[model samples]
Target: IMVLLVLIFHLLFSCSHSLQYFYTAVTRGINFPELTAVGMIDGEKFLYYDGNTRQAIPKVDWIKNNVKPDYWTSQTQIIRGSEDRYKASLVTAMQRFNQSGGYYHPFQWMYGCELDGETGATDGYSQFGYDGADFLYLELRSTSYVAPVQQALITKQEWDVAEAERRKHYLTKECIYWLKKYVYYGKSILDRKVPPQVSLLQRDPSSPVVCHATGFYPDNVKISWQKDGQELHEDVDVGETLPNHDGTFQKRAELKVTPDVWKKNQFTCVVEHKSGDPIHMILTEEKIRTNSAGIIVGLVVAALVLIAVVVGVVMVVKR
Candidate 1:
C-alpha cells in the first residue's frame, strides 16, 4: 500500500508539471513580452509607457539564461527622448551582479531617462521615429559584469555566457544609435521650444549664466562651460540629484562662467557622456538679461559717449 501511495504522488507531480507547460502554450496572456524584448532593462516604474494602462513591466531575464559561470548577474536600463519627455517620463531601471569569492562585489550598470518627441511633430504622428503613442525605442547595455572568460574557448553549455557578453555589446551599440537619433531631433525641438526646467518666467542675471542638466547614468557625465567654443575652467558647481532608488543614479550639473561670456560669446553648457555624443546649450543674450536696467543703462552710456565725441570733433573743425 505504501508503494502504491508513492506511485500515486509521483504521478500527480508529473501531471501538474505537464499541465503547467500545456497551459503556458495554450494561453496567449502568459506570453507577454518582457521590457527587455523591447530593448529596456529592468527597474521600477518611473514613467508609464501606457500611462492610462499599466504603470510598469518586468524586464526580460535573458541575461539570467545567458549567465556566465564566473559572473553572477547582468542588467541594464535605457531610454531615448527629447528634454520634455525624458524629464517628464521619469522612467527608471535596476540591475545587480552577485559575484563569487569577493567580500564586496560591485555591479556595474547605467540608466538613461529622457524624452525624444520630435518625430511626433514632423509627421503629424509622433510615433514615426522613436516616440510611439505607447511604445518608445530604447536599448540598455552593460560591460560592468565582465568576466575573465572568453566565448570562443567555452563549451556549448557555456555559450549562453558568451551570448550574454555579446548581447551587452549589441545593446550598447543599439543604445548609442537611439541616443543619437533622439539628440538630433531633440536639438531641433529645443530650438523651437524652451525646456520646462529652464525658468523662462524668472530672469536672474546673477544665476551664473546657469545651465542645468539631469541625466541617467550620472557617473558617466562630464559637464563643462564653454565660451565661443572654448571650455571654461572656473566656478563649476555640480549638484546632487535624487537617486531613482533602483541602484541607479540621476544627477544635475551647474557651471558658472562670467556674465560677459554669457553676453558677448556663445556661452554654452556642454554635457558629454561615455557612450554617446555630447549635449549642449547655446546661451542667448535675451535668456540672460536678468538685469534689464543694467543693460539699458550700459547702452545709454555708450550712445551718449559716441554723440559727445562727434560734437567735440565738429567744434574743433569749425574753430
Candidate 2:
C-alpha cells in the first residue's frame, strides 16, 4: 500500500509541473523580440500586456464598468495635434540608424507586466537591446527595490536626479502598482527524482553517429561521445536539453564521422543522470547488424530440407 501510494504521488507531481509549464507557455508565451514585432510603416515598436491573469495571449477588457475613453482621448489628442512632427521624427530616426544595416539598431522595445498566483511575488521591468549593450532598462522589484538604466548612458549625478524623480511619479504610481501583482505566479512544482531513458545509435554508413537521451525530469543532464577513451571535441554537435511531450525532457548529441573512422576506432556514448552513475553505451556497426536477412532465410531453408528427409525415412520404416 505504501509503495502504491508513493507511485501515485510521483505521477501526480509530474503531471502538475507539466501542466504549470504548459499553462505558462500557452498563456504568457516566451518573449522573442525579433519575432513578435509590430511593424510600423515609419517606425518599429511592439507592445506586451501581462493582463489581469496569466495567459499566452493578451486580453482586451474595456467594458462599460472599466471604460475610460476620456483619459485615453486626452492623451491621444496631444499626439494627434502633432502627428506630422512625430512622423517626421520617426522617419529621421530610422534613416539615421540605417534600417538597411545595423549601425545603431534598436533591436527591440518592450513594455511588460507579469502576475504571479502562488508566491505573490510581483515585479515588472522594461528592458531594451542586447544585455545592456547601449540599451535602456528599468526594473521595479518591490517598494524598496528599483533599478535604473543598466548602461552608463549619463553621469551618475544626472542619473541620480532622474531616478529620484521617477520613483515619485512613475514607480509609485497606481499603473505600476497594479502590474507588480503579476510575476508568473504559481505554487512552484518541484520534480527532482526522475531518470532519463538513453539510447545510442548510428545512422547510415557515412552519416553521423547520434546519442539520444530522453524521458527524464529536471532538465539538467550531460551527454558525451568518446572514442578510444578520449572525448570528442570537434565534429560533435550537442543540442540543448528540451522538454518532452510527457512533461519529461530530452537531449541529443551527434558525432560526424566517415565509415572508415568509425570502423577503425570504438566510439562510446556516456550519459550522466542526476540520480545514478554515468551510463556507458558503445557504437559499433558489427554489433548492430550481426547477420544479414538473406543469411537467416538460408538457414531456415536448410533446416526444412533435413526435416523432410527424416520424415520420408520414418514413413518407409513404418510401411
What TM-score, computed on C-alpha atoms, does each candidate reach?
0.27, 0.41
Cα lDDT of model 1 by residue, 257-304, tens digit = 556655666767776664356767677765543544354335335434
Candidate 1: stretches off by over 4 Å: 1-203, 240-248, 285-319
- What's the lDDT of the predicted structure labeled candidate 2? 0.42
Candidate 2 per-residue lDDT over residues 1-319, each given as its tens digit: 9999766545433321211000000111223111222111001011121222211221122111243556435534443444344334334434444444323222333333332333333344433332213233453443232223333343234544555446434433543343322111211323344787766554445556667777765566899989998998898888755444344566778778776887799888888986678888788764433223344234335434422221111111100
What's model 1's overall lDDT?
0.32
Candidate lDDT (C-alpha), each: 0.32, 0.42
Best by TM-score: 2
Deviation of model 2 at 91, angstroms = 11
Worst 10 residues of 1 by lDDT: 16-25
The candidate 2 region of ten consecutive residues with least summed lDDT is 18-27
